[model samples]
Target: MHRIAILLSTLCCAVTLMAQPALPPVFAQTDAARMRADAITRFYLAPVRVMQSHGATRPEVLTRITNGQTELGRNGMCLLSNAEGDTASITLDYGRELHGGLRLTLGSSSRPEPSLVRIRFGESVQECMSDTRNTKPCVGYSTDDHAKRDIVVEIPRDGQMEIGNTGFRFVRIDLLRTGVTVAIKEAAAIFRYRDLPYVGSFSCSDSRLDSIWLTGAYTVQLCMQEFLWDGIKRDRLVWIGDMHPEVATINAVFGYSDVVPSSLDFACSEFPLPRWLNNIPAYSLWYLIIQHDWWMHHADRALLERHRDYITQLVDQIDLTVDSVGRFRANVFLDWPSSADKAGVRIGVQALTVWSMDAAAKLCRILGDSAREDKCRAVARRISSHIATPKKLRQAAALMVIAGCMDAGDMAERYMHGIDGFSTFYGYYMLEALAMAGRYDDAFDAISRYWGGMLDLGATTFWEDYDPAWGSNANRIDEIGDPARKNVHGDFGAYCYPGFRGSLCHGWASGPTAWLSRHVLGFEVVQPGCRTLRIRPHLGHLDWAEGSYPTPYGAVKVRHERTAGGHIKTTILAKPRGVKVITDR
Candidate 1:
């Protein structure tokens, strides 16, 4: 019944607004739809007015709805009253000024249901007093020297006040000595306020649900005014903490080693994982590259220059271990390499590390710090040269490079051979890395030939393993029918071990999809100041995907759509600012 009433009311308001083209009558309009329309109109129509008033001998100033023909905070206040409605709210902008201290009083000559009136700072809304249902006041929030009320009072319909109640009459506010500042749409609204040494009134009303006023502007303005330096500082802090936790006491070593500080002893070592997996310090090195990429985006020159040496030294050690043919033997045993024969060098580690080194080099150039540029160039040359060699290990290295393990490339000829690729989760790993490097063409090929073939079957998400011909065991291995060597079990499929395969439906993978839809296809709409938005369409070959993320400014929606010609068109809609639409891309 309530939903039906709301729909009918909305229809009536639409008719009313459509029939007559005039500024809305603020009071007589009782229908909620008309109220909403009025609110929207007020949002776009008003020529924002800023008022500034000051006490002649004090540091205080008055701003917002002031009398005396001077926009001063003194003697300036807004009047909100209605004779027949349940509630009344008024919206005003105090600009950048902090209203130091003030008092709000209710006049006796007003007719409303309840004698009690609610006064709320910020945006205002209206309610019907005819409905007796009401909620209790909210709990209080405490700051250093003040405990401001966080509740608003509801005005009762037909109650009387000394001030005239409209739809039919006039009302006024009397402001005493108070300090305030006002500016008109100069920037986005920052809910942040200055630290006042003294106490001040702060409150919010529930009526805002029915009225939409300065809320949009406030959110929009805040995001537009964000400082770039903050991003750089945050990424830097995360990197430093991850690299130098207090538990890892050694500073001389690039990362945690099996022994303390060096290979001398284990008493003060920073090995957090198991002893057998002791050489896994590469994980921290991987994290450093990710953080450095963010820092580079914000152009943190000093941090980039300072840390470039450390990152370079670390990469140097790993690179030196690679043989003349460009393969590093695995000393760590934990990672699955050659069916639990842990000593065999794993291709995944080298691939990931090379990618990190390439990124560090790219960042150095971006910072314009050429100190490590030559070294990076030399490494890239050596890696390329080594991959070109005909040795089997070099061929694997070449495959990793072509698959975005080192620098991103568009080579489709190299793929891990028939049986091993699917069982190892290498398909997902390669797909993600290649996508990261923007090698969409090559990535799509591998996906279509391998992973997509499995998705076409009845699989809901990705699985750990996939075999082109699982039922057919005609091909012989070692001339013996060993069940362990046969790929008949579901767990033994290639997709099983890979984290990305299967319908895992996790947040981490979803984040990557959002990035692709938002950045690659680039259909997200951007409002100048508002933080929230609707999303554009995203098209990919998989089953439907959806992601909603929160930013400092507001929320964002990313969606995808897959089409012919290997095309994907994405749409991004914003509910707030911080989710930026990269216009240049």
Candidate 2:
């Protein structure tokens, strides 16, 4: 009953059932709607609040930072002007998580020499407030790896210094000098981002859904720096597996950015076969899937053609690993939670292989390699024959459904039962699986409750790992660590992102954005390169919704409103050209 209808670029209905669905959501409020920002740019933001100040002559010194006064000397704010030996520190809240560093403009110091200071960048207020101490497995801790969250630097007298080069919303500055007083000209957040246009967008009658869509878009946008990183704070690398949802988000919003293809290219070169992408067997499957999804969106064969040899070879290599039976013998580590369940992992891995092989067969056919296509189809059929039980695990079950090895309705029921425990990485598939079963309400509610939970936690960007139950006794990320309340950011994480090391802005968690765009606004690519689309509106609860779908021709703006008689009145705001759009009237 729910399909997010998108506007058609109307041309001709040339494609059929072989087509795939579109993805995710984005509403940059006004900025996203108006794509003005450069591909990669920076914006300076001043502190909204001064959390702490020690040994300060002027109590309101740093508080005046909101004025954005970068004037050197004169009545400029003096953060710390201590004659006696005292630990002078000032913590600032930039109000939101951003991908950049801190910039401090020094007016003039009492001493002619440079003044040494320690800068700590944190995704959470609690993380920025603390030093690199008390790091344990389960307990939270801070470090300066990949991107420097903590660093010590010197500010030359009457000069400017930009320090951090990571993702952070809070900054802690500690003065290490006794007699020297440093006057700050300006201290602002150097907000860095790509100048790319927010090509795709989604906004419903619900504000919560709007924010969730925006947050997911912004999260992926932040991760789209030099490459499509998994997270900005941690796991700051081009992880092939994590890029699946990210690529979907890119398709939904940014539309054909080089980051996706470049990162995919990097994944191919960086983690070549035999090693498997990221040394994980499943990640290799993700690589193929990414190519397929990218093909569906931009329909650029250059990527497929560039990695032509590798694609065929990878499929061949995968075939060698399979035995006479369709059972994938590899211990497919799907995700941390799914991996814990070995049997579930077996189901997920087998289905995922079939899914990837399906993509490979199509890709091979496009490349006009019928021999390879036939081989891929045979392999997929064999894998499809051996279906392992999902063991009620939602991720595995979702994977099974997506691969056509399991019934979507059965998996959708299991998915709702354990709504709290969904893999951010695989949540996209779960939503897709739910939609496949015609459970649009289930998918919609899932996206709202789960993805919206992050927004409720005062998250400007999504986290690497999340559990709705975690917010029960958890402190908001914006707030300082309250001993009375649970340390939300500092504590409560498992596997790779444990404790303070957990990334608050992971792109993998941004699946809901794309999910909303595809299922809710419904601009599915039934043909490669959006040659043909099936536009359906699945607005379950919302009265009205409107958004644009990014396509090769241009943005197709579509709107859906509920009539008094409980019927949807659909309208195509923009005119079409080369593409065909199919709708259920």
Candidate 3:
């Protein structure tokens, strides 16, 4: 009887052990996160721009304002006046785009007279001078009160002011009160952004790609303020869906910065249990995916430990939404223009859930929480089993491949052959999925076709949404066969809601910077903080390519060239000591 009891006990113990999942491999802890945070804080100082008004024009003021040669500091003075008939306007150009606070020191007049002043802000030259009443996305402020002393008008903290630390390259200060002399002293914009070194660099045979890379890099830089904003002009708030791609691009370009973790924490804290992030279910999953990417690239154990409980609770919330059949029931938001059907959205959600769970499982293992990790893997398996007909939705299919729900090699060929419905936003992930599937040629072609198309349309910076059929003219309705309109107003969302609508320099659309550096130049992070590196150079159709990726310790420089005999030669110019570089053909 004792022997029989022992056998039963052993069986029970084996069953319990089998039910539990295996933990992830142990990784050594480091102070990289703290060090990065400190470095970022020290470099967070914004470059100031102080410019005086030049000559003014009636319609297009693009030619009037030039960047002042004077040094930016307090107590600077510039006189802005009208010809005595029309509204007095002075345009100030900051040279490049900036996202930060604007301070205009209004010089107090010696006379005891009250004067009203109106100030307008814009991200473009036309936007700066355009009438705010018709302009949909116009940002400006007007004040009626006049003080005897210098008065500083700021974007109020109570949200009463329309414009604050927003994105702008030009400012039009209009004197509203006629015949009132107002001396403007110290017209300065305090630029605020996470001070990150330009560690990543890229140049190739294609000058257009180089230009696109620089433009994309600038676009991403403008969006990196207190948090990862969608755009500088509009919706300057953190949306997890937009943030997923933005964060990836930031990682490749800026390396690991404190803004990323702080942004994640802010998103998680703002939206508690049961509420979807930014009211989108996929956004919530994207939060987890971003967390996984951060840990994988930076290897910040302290970050994982800091948010362990919050991560567990978030995973629990996700678990509650999954049905027995592996279908997700929540708000489904894929991308703009809404191409995906109901079934396709469900499949996309399922794939994203699987991806997030996989990430959560790794995170849980890293945190030494076997129970949640096991649960995450089991749920991911269940969801993966139900993902049928991934090809129905291009976004869904691409995401499935990215999430490891489908074989990248098999899907890459099939998906790359027909990429009919892809916007700039979703195109970012599509390129990533293509690269993962080893379809380097297709990825290159897609970038040339999609992003290149945007360039052909005279896009100085990447846009929020782009349709090839729309052609070079954004105002025309060629797809619908309607008569050409002066401007595409009355469109949905940011298309033309306000005048100067649709973010011209969107951060999420800056995927080519990350793709080119990580894939084409082949500077990938194998271990967190780049302790291990993977150098797989795929210079498709390019004679030569050179770039550098920033690491915690230093920059890793690489140069690749195709030999005359059709052999590819690669050279690592510089890299951190003790870092592993795995070269793959």
Highest TM-score, which number?
Answer: 2
What number of clashing residue pairs does each candidate have, in the order they appear?
69, 22, 2
lDDT of 2 by residue, 178-284 (tens): 87688776678888766566678788898788888878888898899878899988778989889998888889987888888888888889877777888888899
Best candidate, lDDT: 2
Ranking by lDDT: 2, 3, 1
What stretches of model 3 exceed 4 Å from their correct place? 1-85, 90-95, 101-114, 131-164, 180-190, 390-392, 407-420, 452-461, 469-471, 474-499
In model 1, which regions exceed 4 Å deviation?
1-269, 272-288, 293-313, 319-353, 362-370, 389-410, 413-420, 423-425, 433-555, 558-571, 575-580, 583-585
Q: What is candidate 1's CA lDDT for residue 60?
A: 23
Is 1 or 2 the stronger prediction by TM-score? 2
Ranking by TM-score: 2, 3, 1
Worst 10 residues of 3 by lDDT: 141-150
Distance from true location, Cα of 81 in model 2, Å: 2.7
Q: For candidate 1, what's the RMSD? A: 23.7
